[model samples]
Target: MRALALLWGCLALRASAALTCPKEMSGFEGDTVTLRCTYESELRTHPKYWCREVGVFISRCSSKIFSGENSQDVMEGRVSIRDSPGELALVVSLRGLTLKDSGKYWCGAQRLGPDEACPVSLTVVPATAPEATAPEATAPDAAAASPPAGSSRPTTQPDSSSSAVGDPGPASSSHSSMPSVSIPTTRLLAPILVLLALLLAAGLIALSTHMLWGWRQALWAEDAQRGEKVHLPAAARREEEAPAQAPEAEETSAPCRSEEEEEEEEEEPDPAKFIAV
Candidate 1:
């Protein structure tokens, strides 16, 4: 009997040492969620996995989404798993969850015996829409309460006709004649307009600067062309003057040579006359 009791206690202790995980988790569609599963330190070296449970009656993790052998991270599609040996835990991440992903899952570790696993129910729901803001209420205009222009106030006089009969003279309406007007706030429009104005101003400034720069460049080109034209005309005048001055120099030298020849002939005695003497 004592041996049987001891065996039962061992089984209970073994059951108590199973993997631990959250009972339920929830996430919105297109959102990501993280789950941490802890296990005994002895199972730290075992391969860890995060998988979906299949079958209605007998649920089992047949669809393994992600698994990791060591402390390295393992990723498959939108699911990822990482084992932490120091913490003796497995971290699983699910991204871009959809409504179809709402089902039971298991955090499991592979061993020689039956794999250690814990059930975790995940719920995925559609994302909620943002709440709409109410329109701002405007106060009634003061001018609307005033009487119309060119209208005189009539004086009220005591009635002398009725003595005994109670008379409710005129039913004064309590309702205001002015209609309620709702003014839409232009909170976003102001910034958009300012941005557009700034962009337009910047464009105009850029265009003006470009036009001015182009005009200056054209002016500079025209000035350079004018300078070249002026320089070419002066150089042509100098070349033409050079040929004219050369002819004048040759004519002056011809007269000087004629005078020298006449002087020399007159200075020398005639050789024929000397022979005759």
Candidate 2:
């Protein structure tokens, strides 16, 4: 009887000493979650690993085990672990967690055997369910909050209409009849802009013509120097040959000559002063 009692106590101790884990952890699908298990400080150097719980029993780590040297670590496809060389802890990381990953799991240090494992329970929040709960409340709030614009319409618009009818109120009248009593802001500026554009175009055309005329003059001068006659355009030739009317030219130039020049021209030498010419 004494031996059986001692055996039962040891078995219970082993059962209770399985890997330690949280009561529950919540996660989202497609997110990473960590399941941390703390162990006896002396087990720090031992290999750490985790696996899915099977029938409430854990014998060894899963076939995909993560064990490395005391300072380094190991990883499997989606699961990884860290055995802190000094701390009494092992952090097991599950990457790309999915809805299917919610379940009971066990973690252990390799040297501690299956009976010394820790239990972890993971719960995933259904990512779709929150939208239904939150959006339902917000939709009514959004609709109710929309009539702010209509709130001022009753108090303000009638005053503007009264002013535009006969109240001699410039501000109110402008506000009420803006569409009908208006000139385009750009209307006056449009003709000025067109005139300026035309002036600029004419200036550019005159400059181009002047440059071409200068080039022709230079070529003609060069040809004349080389004893080659260069023909002028007909309009240019006619302009050079045409003279002002004689009477008009005399009238225009009469006052320009000095009195001394006219007097010298009128005093001709007498034939007797130049004897026997």
Candidate 3:
């Protein structure tokens, strides 16, 4: 019985030495963390797995989360496990850590007999808050210190009653006397320049329209004068031909009238001889 106990103790020590892992690990909320466990060379072909402890006793791999096949990576939810046979190490990664993720976990390897496991305690802490930044102070404008051109600086005299009651400090006086922020001259001039440009463009357009109307009216008047000049010569020629044609018509009518009078005299000439019969 004593020899059997010694052999069992040596085997337990060997198994403990074969599977080794960190005792504790920590990560911030919303952060990722990696845990590595080294194993003996003889167990390199064994399947490796990661699991979370469920009960208070921290049983070995009670809730398996990820299991690795051969040397390939296996992932379940936010936890992933990968076995590197060359390095004889099992790597497990947990991403997007939360406060509830802090607990006891186990890294284990499967064998024909009992599985070998190592316990790891994880602590997930809340992320730290960022510090507040104070606003920067702005220096007073140099231009505001001097009065503008063509303007007299206004002077203010403190009331005698107020001075007698309490003397105002320099800080208060300086703060109260600080000039209000004056708008930039460029900002004020921008709209004025735009308005002036618009007025100038309107004036130019009106002037052009008036000139076009005047040119069109002059063209119509010129056409009217040219038509009148063309008709005037033709009217004058017709008037001159009318007077010459009128004298010829008068001479032809006078010869006809003399012949008619001679016939009338010859027809009435035998009136004396007929009255004697």
Candidate 4:
């Protein structure tokens, strides 16, 4: 039992020793990438395969690839494997890579020491790079097109670039020829603001007038309730008093009584006074 356990431990250690490849290999999706691995003469007899990496080791690898010079060629779906007898090298061809194919992988021979297994990290990039577009081709204008030889019109080759480079550039001319904004500003906004201000002033005046009138009316009503009456005009009061004093004026204008009638009545005495005597 002890000997069996030791053998198992040694096998596990050998399986753990993985070979090394390019740490990171990047390629565009749908493109083919070649992975070349070299091995020793002792490993030439071992079966080789490719696998997805797990942790530090390889797992879920391809089927055992035929090794030996007799079967020099091997092909799977999109993958191909070849062992070159001259250089003692193993070459793996992976094709039609997708973005999902980017990850760690392993390439190795079966039952070889862990050092023979190769761990490669593959990075598949998107293949959708933008292509450059060519500028549009326009027919030359009549002035710029060269005239046919031997014509007597003496056609001058109009510099196609003359318009672009004038006394003042088109950009400068555009800047200089800008429309006057002051006119529109004064014509459009100034009048509207003035009209709004005038309306506001008129509204304020109307409000003030209404408020003053209401306050005056309220004061007048309160005065009337308190009986602080207003004095009437002289002519109106005189008209009102004239009939009220008519009888008093008539009595005051009458004649006085006689003094002689008062002296004759002085000898008479009361009847009760005479009986007491």
Any runs in candidate 3 off by more than 4 Å, and if so which? 1-15, 57-60, 132-277
Q: How do all models score by TM-score?
A: 0.41, 0.38, 0.41, 0.38
lDDT of 1 by residue, 107-176 (tens): 8777765667777777665653322222321122222222222112221222222211444132111112
Number of colliding residue pairs in each model: 0, 4, 0, 2
How many Å off is the CA of 254 in candidate 2?
Answer: 99
Task: Sort all candidates by lDDT, best to worst.
Answer: 3, 1, 4, 2
Which of the two candidates, 1 or 4, achieves a greater TM-score against the reference?
1
Off by over 4 Å in 2: 1-19, 56-61, 112-114, 129-277
Task: Flag clash pairs in model 4.
Answer: 17-114, 19-117
Q: Is candidate 2 or candidate 3 better by lDDT?
A: 3
lDDT to native, each model = 0.63, 0.55, 0.66, 0.56
Q: Write the per-residue lDDT of candidate 4 for residues 181-229, one digit (tens) a residue.
A: 2222244567678889999999999999999999999999998866644
> Which should have the higher TM-score, number 1 or number 2?
1
Which stretches in model 4 have alpha-carbon errors above 4 Å? 1-20, 54-71, 112-115, 133-277
RMSD of each: 24.8, 28.8, 28.2, 25.6
Instruction: Show pairs that collide, candidate 2.
Output: 18-117, 19-117, 19-118, 20-118
lDDT of 1: 0.63
lDDT of 3 by residue, 1-277 (tens): 9666444323322235679998777655677788989999988887777877542211223456545566777888888888998999998888887777777777877776556777777766565332222132113322322222212223223333433456534322442353333123334567889999999999999999999999999999999999999999999999999999999999999999999999999888677788999
